[model samples]
Target: MTRSLGFGVLLALQFLTRLPVPVQCPWNADTSRWAVRCYPLVGLLLGGILALTGRLLEGWLPTPMLALLLLSLWVALTGGLHLDGLMDVADALGSNASLERRWAIMKDPHVGSFGIIALVFLLVWKGTLLLALLESGVSLAVLVAVLALGRFGAVALLVLSPAARPEGMAWAWKQHLGHRDLLLALWPLPLCFWLLPGGMVLFAALVPFLLLYGLAMIRAFKGINGDIVGAAIEGGELWLLLVAWIWWSSAMG
Candidate 1:
């Protein structure tokens, strides 16, 4: 049981980040499915790293430059995986094409103009929000909480969402994710309350919005896939950062 859970964490790190998960574990559908349960763990670890970076560089660099550097580190850590999904989803949605055509566009190796613009806007928005939060004296813990919850959102989507295709990583994950797995995933929920300022209330409000967002993505794509899941994770992270800043600003005022 211990080994299984350890592999789950390993698989999650391997899948979600560019980190070298040096130890090889038994690879199978079961492990792949179980790995989703640890997605938030990976997010928390990533958040911790970012939080440390913020703390170490506090007052050492200009706000804008610090935010930019953190954003770059974020992209580098995740290998731009979710950002790629965000861009693909944007391009597909922008095409105004049929579902089949949209899917093809997402699968295409080349990025479109819409993808480029969307990526730019997302990065800029996140950087600006980070700058605002740092300037407002918000703790790095808030950022960590946001990152953790963002990945938790992804795991929730996986458990709740139907698969768009019978093949590929999404389907493989879906096949293994059960109600029990979902329960296991929720173990990290307490981290939100411990890490954020108004986390409980904000989390309560965020639930419906996340549900609605998931529904919209499913409606737009006809079903959820790996790309949609990634997009949701990225969107949720940015949304939390924005919400945190607003909450912090109002509180300070």
Candidate 2:
């Protein structure tokens, strides 16, 4: 019980989506481990912020500009945190060599041609979806719902995956991913139904997207180590971004 609350607070503080209450844990024990566990919850909280931001700015700017700004907001709020991982992951997968070579590329911390292309396409994909969602008159629900689920998606990975590393934060989380892990992970799923009136239709649609996403990341994980957690988060976000964009984009035009 204490661990869960502590995990939740660490997430709120780090993600800084401006939640109402303080995101403080019970004394910051094992901060790094907690950070990994709470990482996905950040996306869920951002869902509310995303909706509020959208509502506040609706009709105040053009859809494209608003979309761009919305994404910019996330970049600033998270301190360009996951986007960097997205780039690294892209660079890793961007390689056509063996798994060992891809892992080497991911750790370089240098951007390559493939990294640049993937990052741009993902940002555009996310921004375009936001614009389309706002334009489609479903901005509030879709933004909030998708953001929430995307985060949940990350947590799901935590519950399902074993730490690829032996002594790092990911390893620590592996120790904690016992029965209680399911409690934190499953609680967020139902929230989607409330946020999106489309209900299970939206949920059903996300499954295949997630499946393909998981498969793609498996190849990357096989190459790199557990550092791919960061990459997985960004991948989940991008997947949702594309899903939302395609749905609302089709509706708008």
Candidate 3:
């Protein structure tokens, strides 16, 4: 069981981030399920790196530059996989076309004007939020929780929602996942609560956002897909950052 869990973490790092995982794990339903459960761990790893970077550069660089650098590192770590999904979903939803047409738009290799605009807006907002959080002296624990919860939201979508298509990465991940898998995904929650001051509030806030976003995706595409799941990760991060900024501001003031 320990070996399987280790392989699962490695597989998740390989699949979700640009991190080097030198071993090849055989892909099967069990391995896939393990990978799904470890998604939040991948997010925690990313958050750790970002938090370390921020701490090291805190006094040396201007807050704006540091925020931009952190944002760039965040994207680099994930190879912009979730950003691509965000852009695709933006293009598809902006088209206001039929469901079939929107799906086709998502598959198109070329990004549309809407996609470009959405990308710009998301980056700008995230960067701004990062700047605010940093300026207010955000805690490393908050940073880690923000990222872990964002990916946890992805796991939630993967397990709870039906896939838009029968064959895709999201569908494959969902295939072997059951309600029991959600308990495994909750592994990071206690750590988050222990680390952050108002962790329960953060978790409470995330649930409604996911529910509304999941429902919206279902309404938009009839079911969720890899793109939808990716979009959720991106959106969840943004929302969590916003919440953290607000919470920190109120506390500091």
Highest TM-score among the candidates is held by which one? 3
Per-residue alpha-carbon lDDT of model 3 for 70-167, expressed as tens digits? 99999999999999999999999999999999999999989999999989999999999999988888786777888899999999999889898898
Q: Which order, best to worst by TM-score?
A: 3, 1, 2
Evaluate candidate 2 by giving its C-alpha RMSD to the native, one decimal: 3.7
Candidates 1 and 3, the one with greater lDDT: 3
* Evaluation by TM-score, superior candidate among 2 and 3: 3
> Can you list the residue pairs that collide in candidate 3?
none
On lDDT, the leading prediction is: 3
The TM-scores of all predictions, comma-separated, are 0.96, 0.80, 0.97
Q: Write down the RMSD of all candidates, one decimal each.
A: 1.3, 3.7, 1.0
Please identify which of the two predictions, 1 or 2, would achieve the higher lDDT against the true structure.
1
lDDT of all predictions, in order shown?
A: 0.85, 0.63, 0.89
* Cα lDDT tens digits for candidate 1, 1-253: 6677889899999999999989887877667766888887888889989999989998899988999999999899999999989899999999999999999999987999999998999999999999998899988888678877888888888888888888767777888787778778767768857877577655665587679988898898867888888988888888888888888888998
Which stretches of candidate 2 lie above 4 Å from their native place?
A: 2-4, 15-41, 223-227, 245-253
Candidate 3 lDDT score at position 33: 85
lDDT of 3 at 138: 75
Better of 2 and 3 by lDDT: 3
Worst 10 residues of 1 by lDDT: 197-206
Error of 3 at 192 (Å): 2.3
